[model samples]
Target: MNDHDKHIRVHIVDDDPADFLIIDELLLQSKRFQFEVNHISSISEARQELIDPQCDVFLLDYFLGPETARDLLIEARKVHCPAPIVVLTGVESGTLDDEVIQLGAADFLPKGDMTVSLLERTIRHAIQHKRAELELEQMVKRDPLTGLGNRLLFEEILEGSLARCKRAGTRLAVLFMDLDRFKEINDSLGHPTGDLLLLLIADRLRSVMRESDFVARIGGDEFTILIEDLHDAEDALNVARKIIQAVSQPSAIGGHELNVSASIGMALFPENGDAPIKLMQKADIALYEAKRKGLNSVQCFTSNLQTQLERHLNIEKGLRHALEHDHFELMLQPQWDLRDRRIAGFEALIRWRFGSELIAPSDFIPVAEKTGLIVPIGEWLLQTACRYLVKWRELGVSHYRISVNVSPLQLKTGHFVETLQSTLKSTAIAANLLEVEITEDSLLDGHEENPKVQQDLSRIRELGVKIAIDDFGTGYSSLRYLRQFPADVVKIDKSFVSGNGGEALAEPEICRAVVTMADSLGMDVVAEGIETISQLTRLRAMGCRMGQGYLVSEPLAFDEATQWALAGEAVSR
Candidate 1:
């Protein structure tokens, strides 16, 4: 290339014209390169040029008037400046060089030491290094599989979009979408097939984007879109509808026809939230609402949703606090031996005390599971239950064992098995003294296929701990789980045993079938929700050997339970 063809446009930000002239003379002496230097005298003017840079290189004075270049450098990086900046100073200080370099400058140079070759080389190297960073950053912003923007790019562009909309007095929307039942596809069809399906979906998403819309993939099956519409967000809703319809259509992947639906949540700018993170969070919450409503649904952020979110956040914060401060209470519900009409064992239930408000497990347990705080909370429960069980055994309470309800999330973590083994060994409690109860639904969801799940259950069984399938017959494939899963007890769900209409107990046939099946499998049956004489009589007649409900006694505190155990009262009466 000729020297004139190798042209460079440089911005020189310095207040002193004499300093600019000296640097300008040094550049004039270079024969290998052509230079165009524009001198900027004020920091306020420099701010404007930095935001919309049109230069290959920027020469910023270390001190411009009363302010340094630190704030300008921060603003440039925040907006993602494409050009490299070399900080210039008349003072020869190595410390200044290091400080300026750390603040996003391409290089540091003392202006008094400049020469023709030194200036040319420093400018070329700075430009090359900045170009390399920009190239790497471009690659980092893109989602590799789909070639769409990733989360980092989304956040970067989101701020710019917000700024432009604010200036124009327009509105923008954030759309958060998650593919419905994506895990099922991944598990059944294999990851390669799932990836093919994702690529197809991404192409369809690209086909629906407008000129002002930016699309990105931030999760495996999650996508986000930014829509800058002039007026109200009807355009965003239309896009959501298009995505649901387009994604729901069947696609042929690897000779298999597969279909997936999208659940989209939309949050408007300046209304749902004023900032990027808040706006995205609100959109995600809306997406969750759409998923809850059903497949292929679109939902908007609402105040009612905010209220619910506030409660969830409150519970989440309280759970973390409880973990730190030891604010949880373990309540024990007595399990009765129906045939013997006496207490057999106990089911350990956890309760939260948040200030004066007593929160039931039904209230906070869902939040804990959602936040993944259940891992530590669940471990604490197990440890406390084992400690109490040992105390009871030492006191010679006439109970068989304590059954602790285990969350499916806890088992999925893969550390629960090790934690259980450790707790058992440390407490010096026999495996028979503790029974682990998992919901029938968790098993029905193909959890048994997971190696971690299998390892946990098998290892626990190997340790001689009994397993009980709690809330039986409540899930779609509960009956199917029974064939593959081995358990010592089956607790029939309350919905089947509770009375409805004129019938003394609802779904008597279901209860009879469950009891009969458990018996055939040599698994003991516990009929839950026994709240009356008639229900208890019918369950005992159905050969349900053990049960627990308010009819026997409500869940009691530690002291109350210990007292009840020592009393050895008849629970059936």
Candidate 2:
């Protein structure tokens, strides 16, 4: 390459015109490096040149008119000039040298000893270093796996895209992708294989999408794709479906074939939300609905989804308030001994009292489970139930147990045992007075073979608390595991008890078999959903030990339950 090919812009700011001309000519004479020298004869001229849109290097003289070169270098910073400033001085002024170096000059050169090679090498090195730094800054914004903009980059770029789209009267699309059953895949196949699968999926998605779209892995098994200039909502949906099909393909790692599906949700710009946070939230809401409907599906954010999101946000806000303010109340429904028609014990049901508004257990339990609000909710229920039972004991009301339903989410938590122990300890309630009611649907998912479901039940049983399989016959109830489970009671679900058309003739035979089965295993049988004398008589005839339903009484608040317990205590006396 020619010397001019490696061109350098040298801004020589000096008080003396003789010193400036001598340096300029010497730089021009160098054959190995060509210098495009800007002779700014004063600090004021240097400041004007610094603001110009150009770069290469600053060869600053130590003294420039009335101000020192250090002062001019400081002025260069105010103009946002990023090039390396090499301070040149004629005299050996140590203090001046130190001040100029500290003031942002890249290097110092004694005017008498300076050579073209030394000056050229320092400027090139500084320029190369600055380029490398800028490149690294750009790389930091990208996801290493997907090579797409990451969350940090997405936030930065989303504003620009929104502004550009709005100016052009266009729309942008944001799609959120969450791989279904990804945890199971990671657990069984190892994380390395899972990571490889994710990379492969990202590649497949990139191949199918437009070049204008950006893809990023936001979380484990979760990715976001942003498409610019998406004029219609259907365009985003089409891309989502394509991604769904692409992710659904079989992946092989170490000779193990893995089949995975994804749930995708999309939100359009200017319509769904005005900001990145709001748009991502809308996509998340749609994603939740997609998962709820079933995986391997795509959902677009509509007014309904936004409404649901608002409602959920309100509920979540209420939940935080409820936890702190003691807005929850416990209701106990009596379980009757089928043979004697005597009250066996009560099942503790949770009710939310938001001022005068009544919130049923069925209303918020599922939300609690999904949001992981169940962990706190479960803790509260266990603690409250235990306290209620202890209070009943203090009032001289003896009871068998207060059964509380445990959500599957609670059973899966690692702190289940500790929480229960703490609750019993705090309330001074006997462990035997507490029963955890888990549903059959939670125990079986069809995909799991030799599941630890029964083992979890056994752990609860080890806690000295009775375990009951509530809504027993509704799930994929394998008789094999049913015989081996650690359940003390099996409450036949309302569906089985009510039967078809309310006749319940077939239900009696089924109930009898279940009771016989429970008896054979030495487990108590509780026929739930009994709402009539005939239902009670039929259950009693079948040798059922306990029955709980609206027939005896619906779930009553703590005060009502206390009154009933007192009345029962009086009757016994």
Candidate 3:
């Protein structure tokens, strides 16, 4: 049995017969690979063999009768071709290589520089690389625990479905569902049991959906259903009611009976907006309102949610204007060290001044984040905060630092670390004197290791910039990530101090656990929204060293914050 006996099927897609013979001879001369080659001279013939799995790889030429293989490469992708494609170009050009790859070429080979060994290696690597990519794509598109379509898959299907609905003038519905009080169950039963509950819930959801409908698990306890050929918005309501009824049934796992209910918000195509993201947003808004109504209920995108929609639209418009016109303001709130009785530093907060009216961050920040204006806005915030830190250093508080909040979207970009480094350089601020606050979700994006985020955070830490995990306890990340993160400080969310709203007071034990956990991890804890003297007293007793809130004094301008800091004694007012 010779190793050469194993056949490697090759498809040479070039118009020139002489070039195809040369390539065919190259493959045939390989003693390591038994060659079965096919040649196609025109685009019409190439399209027929594109979906043929008999061909292991395609050697595509750059110029095929004045029409480039670039269009063919895109066509291969559109058809979901399985075989790896290697583009054969006459000359080496860096710009053309990038363009071909982006157009879905597996490898770009310059014909003038192509050797037997190089050709073999290129073809072998392309096949292996494509294989690995396909495997990774399958994993990326599915929920690992439940084996259902994930958000990425959901978006792809939603876009395609929306296109079909638009062309056919058919109606479709997007039902965004959330498990009401699922967190309580998850907390009580542990993650293992919670996972089992989710699988059963996923199956129940699948049973409710028709063959034509699509269901995806967008989050740990949230699912989205896409129903095409919808007669009316009421068709979606019936589906939602069926899903609600199915979810309300009891689930048995590990000898324990668990019960959960889903609240669904429906958005119909054309009615809710023609775009995919727009419809999703409408459904999300309706879901939030449905959640407000109680469990096992359904709400459609209607005039009731229009107020929020209008507000978001207005804020989006205002945000674009503000970013262009430099209408944003930065304010600093003092953080007092509980034990030392000195001002620790100030956390920089952003405010948007729209004409004469001052809009709260609560109203605009989320809008900014959704619109992806956060990245540019975040850069401005960091640069401005570092400048303020320089001002504070000049005001005789060199040891005190300034903390600026960063959205997760900002950290996802690989260039964020460069932004941080440049800001430090431009402002001439000490690295340790400027801190970047990243949310927990930023550190861990749905249990996947985000290399870009981790790399940026690690590089920022190496530059001596202080890293604080902002809104620590309120996020969906696990406690075990504390050791993995390079954070120097953990700012406990205001909800932990303010009792998470409503009349329900926060237990001291819950607050103590977080402080103790951060302490064990060698991270300093800062309590946020410390409005009450009683809350400050409790946190101090709990060994929390620093805090910032209304009690520490509301956000102040440059001169006022400096004056407050220079007061030497911590003022309650």
Number of the predicted model whose lDDT against the real structure is largest: 1
In model 3, where is the ten-residue run with the lowest total lDDT? 499-508
lDDT of 2 by residue, 1-573 (tens): 556548877777777888888888778777777678777676766665564426577777886656777677776655445566788888887687688767777778898987767766777776776567547856997788767667876765666566557656889998889999876666566667877888888888889888777787776678888888876888888888888888899888768888889999888988998788899888988898899889798999999987888777777777778988888888888787776667778898888875677766676776677689988888888888888887889888766589998876776665777788777777778888889988877755411422455566777788789988888766655566576677888888776676553644337777887888888888888887777777777777778878877766788878877776766521221
Candidates 2 and 3: which is better by TM-score?
A: 3
Model 1 steric clash pairs = none
lDDT of 3 by residue, 116-154 (tens): 788878888888888898888879899988898999888
Give me the runs in candidate 1 sitting further than 4 Å from their true place.
Answer: 1-9, 17-40, 48-52, 135-149, 159-170, 187-190, 335-344, 370-372, 407-422, 438-463, 466-554, 559-573
Clashes of 3: 0
Model 2 residue runs over 4 Å out of place are: 1-170, 177-207, 211-224, 244-263, 291-297, 366-376, 407-416, 438-461, 469-501, 505-527, 531-545, 563-573
RMSD of each: 4.6, 9.3, 9.5
* Comparison by TM-score, 1 against 2, better one: 1
- So what's the TM-score on candidate 2? 0.61
Sort by TM-score, top down from the best: 1, 3, 2
C-alpha TM-score for every candidate: 0.80, 0.61, 0.67
